[model samples]
Target: MIKFLLIVNRQGQLRLRKYFEEKVVTHGEQREIIRQCLSAVDKQNFLVEFKDFTVVYKKYGNLYFIAGITSNENELAVLELMHHMVETLDKYFDRVSEIDILYSLDRVHMVIDEMVVNGYILETSQPRILVPLQLLDVARK
Candidate 1:
């Protein structure tokens, strides 16, 4: 199960953070986790083990999509999940970038929420995942 997802840049600036677990993590601990992930970005392995969880991360342009999952989770599957997310974002934004995520923060969150719920993947079909957002756009017109 996924415990949290973090979007951080090369400079250690956090863009988005979503926690799925019921436990509360303090801001300090969250910062430390980001720091650890940033430090491990240059490592050869994409999977990094922490005290209680494992981090699976992938880099897209200047942004890094990092997922903190249980030790028993499949790392490769998480990587694929990240790729799907990037592809979805790219399709939605016509070339997704850090700036796009920064500006459309809420929409980005919505997209992730569409893909995952309570730490588990709810949907993998991009078209199905996008339908609700499209409906929302049509409603606003």
Candidate 2:
């Protein structure tokens, strides 16, 4: 499975680190899906590779983290949508002090955890729970 760990800094820059498993398990157009997913984020390309379809990162910066099990056959739209959502969140949360966000509640999906000290933003450390894209759409129903 392919795992993506995306992080955001106080500078509003996004960094994505892909976890390559070194053994391709889900094969048959994996790159194509990734391409489309990148496009959905308004990005032309992604620095991603796979091995066994697994990508693991212990952590990143003082702001974010995620973990997921993705197969070659996983829907492109889903991956793209998730990434898009992450981008959107980063844009709006300019002054977040801390947040614990889960990518998906359905399976053993990704987790995004951040800690923004008052020194970083202000004397305000309001915690928030950012919902997964799937759930964000669901409650609107």
> Over the stretch 1-141, how does candidate 2's per-residue lDDT look in tens digits?
334434433332333433334433333444443333333343333323344343222222343332334554244433453454344455444432234333322211222222122112111211232344446558769
TM-score (C-alpha, index-matched) for candidate 1: 0.91
> Cα deviation in Å at residue 73, candidate 1?
1.3
Give one digit per residue, the lDDT tens place, for model 1 in 50-91.
668887888788998999899778888889989999999998
The prediction achieving the highest TM-score against the true structure is 1
Identify the runs in model 2 with alpha carbons over 4 angstroms from their true place. Answer: 1-4, 8-43, 54-69, 72-75, 95-141
Give the clash count for each candidate: 0, 8
In candidate 2, residue 128 scores what lDDT?
Answer: 34
Which candidate comes out best when scored by lDDT?
A: 1
Structural RMSD, model 1: 1.6
Clashing pairs in 1: none
